[model samples]
Target: MKIFKYLILLVSLSVVMTGCEKEFLDTEPASSISAEQVAETPAANEALVNGIYANLRTYGVGGTTAHTDYGHRGITAGLDNMSNDVVLNNFNWYIFFYNYTGRVQTSSRASLIWNTYYSVVADANIVINGLGTLENRTAEEDALFGQALALKSFALFNLVRIYSPSYIGNESAPGVPVPDRLTFDGKGRGTVQDVYNQIIPDLEQAVTLLEGFNRSSKQQIDQSVAQGLLAEVYLETGNWAEAASAANAARTGYGLMTGEEYVNDGFDNIGNQEWMWGADIDSESSTVYASFFSHYDSFLGGYAGALDGYKLIDANLYSMIPETDARKDVFVEAGNEFGFPPLSNTKFVDATSSFEGDYLYMRSAEMYLIEAEALVRAGQVDAGIDVLVELVSSRDSGYERPALTGQALLDEIYLQRRIELWGEGFAWFDLKRLSKPLDRTYEGSNHRDFGKFMFPAGSNEFLFQIPEDELNSNDNIGAGDQNPS
Candidate 1:
């Protein structure tokens, strides 16, 4: 059997990884071989890792993955729903999501996101086990196994957020699928706790597995990435002090980027400082071209410019951004091409290679924010406020706010989250986690709901109908039970 030698990716490969999808599996990236061949040697592991990343980069069979980033914002005020012929058409779905009835859902974005991350988990398993089957160990063999575990744990953490309700709502809410750790099996939806529990062990294993190994952002799983991911999971689980510790660990090892460095470095000469971990996607091979930023109103011109009439920045929410925020400059008006003010989201906009240089899965700034949240949640309110203010001040000089605690402090954190993470896809879960009110306005432009709002959660509409196929195909788990009103 024909087999190439390289089994693991280099840090630089992270940026180079995305460009050529078609050639990915067949052509060797540092190495290549069939799965059976990999069971014999470490060469097949890279192909498997490539497959895992593809799942993260592209939407899968059901298209449930879109919600993690763009769609998350869509459900929140970061986006304006243009075709609001109904509540669903209008983002007013946020208003009355629980009351929604017409359950003709296509892709919740979160659903696709969940499926894709699971695939990443599976790919990690393949690498984890396949590496063991090899005889003589090489640096290549070790790298493949370590990277696989970190990436897998990373994917699972994201799934927990979307599928399971937030930490605030139900600590025990049923979460999403918890994938097989050492093996790949797509079956089973774990309770929210089950999935959350699965992540910590996996991450701990990754931390141990990846010890001493070092590589750039692309092919290797470094200590900071694991720590950063763990901190996030801890926060999600409301282990505030642990969350703060992990964030501190992550931030300490990976230095912070100055304000300018955070914005420009990742794509250029300063790349090392800003990213703790990110997918290295290049210009030529990128399919997404930063689609969220592509819209016309962006002035920066991303894919959204051509898609027409969909994904507007919510006027109600946009108005809340104080003019002083450097972050506010991230959104640009595309000149109402679809009709309304034509606000385009540009935070992800990268002029390099269709504006989607690479997908940053984790960054240093998040650790700062994570620490701030965790500290505050742990009852160190003033300390947390100090961290947040220091961090935000670096991002925008004049942007200022008074120290706050209790509910008020949390609210301030929430506001920053909405504005800062906007199109990066953190909104829907935030609202749910915070238990924000849901209501709808029917001023939708679509033909479906010329003017009616509805709720799709809690009382009016609880469980999203299981994907049509699962209901028809999987007898073990048919239409899921609805959420309580």
Candidate 2:
């Protein structure tokens, strides 16, 4: 039920006349290029693709100037706060997420998530449907078309996961509406299967279309990224073999960072050896205080550093790391000089301590873990163990391959994933996909008392409620179509 209000505003601004001369005011703006013309020009099509990527990092896409309403990363940080691994020292920015109110139908977080991703979907559709038929597409057109399809799939995948139940057993559950065209008319909530039917095919086509397209920068989606995304979708659907194959294919050329690189180098660079996909944030495009590092990086001069917004790791999870593990160095120990929480994270610091810290969306390390997990789940325990060993050995020199098999080995990979990807925003989705509960009430837990919530597997709290605005505005989604409170 999210409207294209921002799109209308953007288009309106494009044609606004700025000069005072009568001739200038009367002349047609270059922005008034027809859709057919745009479709026929490769550069124009590329520019449109660039706009879609720009919106991913742009501030205020959630229809508000609220500090917590930045684009994709905003929703990601909120998801991590909802998980058990992250502990906020004090409630200032993402308090609703920590206290479990953000997912409610009436909360701003619900609307923010719904509005932002749907806007991406709608924009991608403009590029996708605008292109002419498949027979005579140029190489550049194929690449541009592939990027649009990949972006659409990425947005829809996140939407379906956030708004509905996990895909394994709830295929028939109602999911967010899938709008294939640029229209204002309300669309009904479709089945979970219906959304995936669109996502899977889109990703597959994106991979094929992007086959030989080498991107000049990491901000753009290429074939490997598309394949990695497909591996994730396959993993969630329990297609273990397919997941393993696609993950292996995706991580072929990317190597794991050495332990020194993992520890000393601030994780704010897209050029890092392990990084496969990330935002290339710079001064001109920086969102200043409304950025990922502002709320998460303790060394920055923004919220986390200046206002006691220290993002801490759960004490129990911190305790699980051995002294030999390099990953443990990222979190501070108790009685630190800064007077922050015992395990406040230093993993996401900016070396320059500026607002231009880059945001990492995916890395080669994730592909290895996914490949390992899928292999183990598919009963290739020995191959899975080897993959897991290769990854963990890079982080912990003293570590030897555990003699475990089956569930024990699988559990170890899960632990590694938790340690490696802590604040990069996979926590809540991981918990939901594995059908695990959010249990923060354990003894010696560092989770704040007010946020020590316990929700069992398959609880209604795991799913975000469809925002009230959607219900009131979309005639197709009535009271009966709403998710249970």
Candidate 3:
């Protein structure tokens, strides 16, 4: 059996790990396999692909052992904390994010987001470069190659959005560098347009290559997942028709969870039919204290439960949820049986109560929302509303198809997105894409007192400054390249 070494990021592979401030080192980075050990056979290729997925859930990928640094979920938790919708009671793990300090150039959170995504890009580049060409490749080989492209595209998409300004008016703005497997040299930042140009084509090719490929797990990217990713890219780039089409295509087979399913099964299961993509965390894979459940699951004796680190829906947002809505039940009300805070969430309880709650990365509900939003934005308001009604009706039996039109209807869709996807990490990015301000200081605000400051649309505070380490290490990004603090 052929086996390739599982290489973590080498200084040569990713910009993040490239050693020293003054001059780039030729020395091997900590925990890396040499180029010579990289194999090209199917079995070896499969192992490399598995490693890419593992990085999505692996702890300490951000070069920190901080409990808040556990892979993608950690990033999501931070992002949600930055939004007004999710409120944290205490200043323990995500205080920086809540107070808008995490995006500062010097913060570890900034470095964590930059390093982790770039590392994924670096690893994906290795798989892509190893595979070489698509012509005459076997079915297994094509799928592997496509997955690598999709992963790279996914990583770059996140990086560009995090570091650069929104796509619409800021296409010419500085974006993250697009490095490939063989690009050993340091590279300059691409424009936002340049990054999306790479992202769109890569996802398009992935959509084609992954056709008819059946993944063994939801964690693996397949044709629909790639389509879903493409839909998101299109939506961000303001390609409304393409976004709607792709989103509609992406949700073809997945069904929404019924009210019972939503209320009974805590939103911690990867096996949920609505969950199109998620991490299937178990005893072995679970990070225990550093896991998503620890922070988010209020009933599971984790941080939120035992340490008073409870997260709650913003009072303003919570008030919008109808009493009849099943989604409202997830947030523990006043005089609840649990004796927790009035709005402490019971939405994310670990079914095992063992800190093994599965992480939701992507789901069909997001696609339906994306399709509806894109359709409405594209002037297909009725079609978009139809999609919205189908999704909302599943969660709220009393949901009435609104007679709202124009911005009112679009606002309703946005409200549904907030209600539906609140904790799964879309809030801050959604604010950025929509050019909306962070408004947490309303009359009935539940935001942490320190986090009450509001910023206008397109505030520099919304941007995560390129980390100082990257500026010092990568010759391309400099003091001038940093986003305004």
* Model number with the top TM-score: 2
By TM-score, is 1 or 3 better?
A: 3
* Tens digits of lDDT, candidate 2, 179-241: 856564578988999999999999999999999999978888999999999999999889999
Better structure of 1 and 2 per TM-score: 2
Off by over 4 Å in 2: 4-30, 132-134, 182-184
Tell me the whole-model lDDT of each prediction, alpha carbons only.
0.52, 0.82, 0.82
Q: Where does candidate 2 clash, by residue pair?
A: none
* TM-score of every candidate relative to the true structure: 0.73, 0.94, 0.93
What's the CA RMSD for each of the models?
7.2, 4.1, 6.1
| After superposition, candidate 3 runs with Cα above 4 Å error | 1-39
The ten-residue window of minimal lDDT in model 1 covers: 1-10
Q: Rank the candidates by lDDT, best first.
A: 2, 3, 1
Q: Candidate 1, residues 1-485: lDDT per residue as tens digits?
A: 00001112332133224343654444455333445665555555665665555545542222433322322112322212311111122332222232232222333432333334544565576677667556676776666676787787777666555444665556566665554544333345546767667678878776666677666434245777788878878877788999998988888855654556445432322256656654455554344532333332233343344433234445546666777666655455556443433444444445553545555556677778888888999998888888788777876768666656688888777777666555444555554555554344424222233323444443223233334443344343435632332
RMSD of 1: 7.2
Error of 2 at 430 (Å): 0.8
lDDT tens readout by residue for model 3, 1-485: 00011234343244333312212122333345444433346655565566667677778778777788878888988899998789998876888888988898889898888778877777777768777654578899889889989998998898888888899999999888887557545567879999998999999999998999999888789999999999999999999999999999999999889877887888889888888887778776788888888999888777888888899999898999998899998898789898888788878889999988889989999999999999999999889989999999999989999899888988899999999997998998899998989998888787878888789999988889988877777777678877888
